[model samples]
Structures are given as C-alpha cells and as structure tokens.
Target: MEFPDDLKYSREHEWVLVEGKVATVGISAFAESQLGDVVFVELPGTGDSVTKDEAMGVVESVKAVSDVYSPISGTVLEVNDDLPDNTELVNDDPYGDGWMVKIEMSDPSELEDLMDAEEYQAFIAEAES
Candidate 1:
C-alpha cells in the first residue's frame, strides 16, 4: 500500500488534496482495497454544503456499502461525473482519476485534524494489527 506524502488522510479513510481553498477528496487506496470491487458511487451535488467528519457520499462495493466522509467543512464545487458510469476507476486509480469531489473550504483549520501520509500509514498499521 502506498500512501502519497502529498495528501492528508482522515481516520475514516478519506484522503484530501488541498490547493488554495479547494480540496479534492477521495478514498485512499487502503480503503478501496478493503471495500473490494466498487460497484456504485453516490456523490453530493455541486454546491451542496458538507460538514466536517460527516457523510458526504457513499461507495458501494461487493463486500459492503460505506459512507465517504468529508474531512473538512466546505461547499462541494464539483463531483466526478465519471464515477457512476465507471466505478472500476475507484479500484484502479484511487489516488488519481478515482477522486470523488472538489470542495471549496469553509474552514481550512479543519485540515489540522487530519493525518499526513506518514501518520496515516501508522494508523492503518495499528488498525490491521
């Protein structure tokens, strides 16, 4: 499992990539692996307000249906329209094209609550044990 150092991770297994005030959100590779094959994705509409640590969307896999949480408070700027039509991308490129949404942050401070790649690696390691 490779946790890219450029991203921040939530304990719920969501990853965040922030540029300016916009954040791109997605499930980490580890989360996708645990979910098995992704069959469906339900994303919040553009302009929807999302609270930190709350369920903003869902990913359904062959194993289970899981909530995809928002790591920061924000208004959704965009959703990956390709997901509903091509769910396999979530498994094939979790860090790239598999990204779910872009959020215009309401509070950048909320990022402080998330873990960096190194910390997230340790977190999942502890979880697996």
Candidate 2:
C-alpha cells in the first residue's frame, strides 16, 4: 500500500525511479504483498532491449506468477542477481535492494506517460475494489 511520490508507475504494478537517463525498476509494495512469498525471480540479461509496457521478466511467488513490465523503453543495464537466490528481499526492501533492474531509457519522454504515486494508488484502489 506504500507508493512513494518520487517514482513513476506502470499499470502492470512496476515502479520506475529515474536517475538521469537510467532508471531503476521494481514491483510496488502492493504487488509484493499480493504475490505472497516470492520464491523465484526470472531476470532479464544485461544489454537486452526492452519495450515499454512489455514484460521484461517474471516474479514467481508461492501464490502465483506475475510478469514484470518495463515502464520505459530501454536496454537493460543491470539485474539484481541476488534476487533469484533470495527473493524475499523484494518483500523486505522493494524500493531499494528489491529493485529488479537498471535500464538506460531510450526515450526519456516516455516517462511523462507513467502514473505518479497518487494516481497509482488510486489505480490500486480501483483494482482491489
């Protein structure tokens, strides 16, 4: 239920923290809670080109599997390998250590299209109800 104001969100429940042309991505705290205990994280490789709104990877929780979507078009620059071995980090620190990938956004303007914290929270509320 915690959605930080500084980040952008995808409808798919992914959040992006932009820093210059690079952005860090992770699922929202709401998403992790819904997924239950995360067991496996299928990460995309470095240098992989990703399109906006497309699935970049997947997170498999004890309850179900969920696709991780890219909030911005970019080339994946880094992945948190530790996540695959210790998926609970996602639940423990979704905004920091739980970050799934770092991407060099191909078009920064696309960031303007993503939802802000308030909008995303509203989206979550609507989805839940």
Model 2 CA deviation exceeding 4 Å by range: none
Question: Candidate 2: lDDT over CA atoms?
Answer: 0.92
Where is the poorest 10-residue window by lDDT in model 2? Answer: 1-10
| TM-score for candidate 1 | 0.99
Q: How far does residue 127 in candidate 2 sit from its true spot (Å)?
A: 1.1
Question: Tens digits of per-residue lDDT for model 1 on 10-108?
Answer: 999999999999999999999999999999999999999999999999999987999999999989999999999999999999999999999999999
For each candidate, how many residue pairs have backbone atoms clashing (under 3 Å)?
0, 0
Candidate 1 lDDT at 33 equals 98
Candidate 2: clashing pairs of residues: none
Model 1 C-alpha lDDT versus the unseen true structure: 0.96
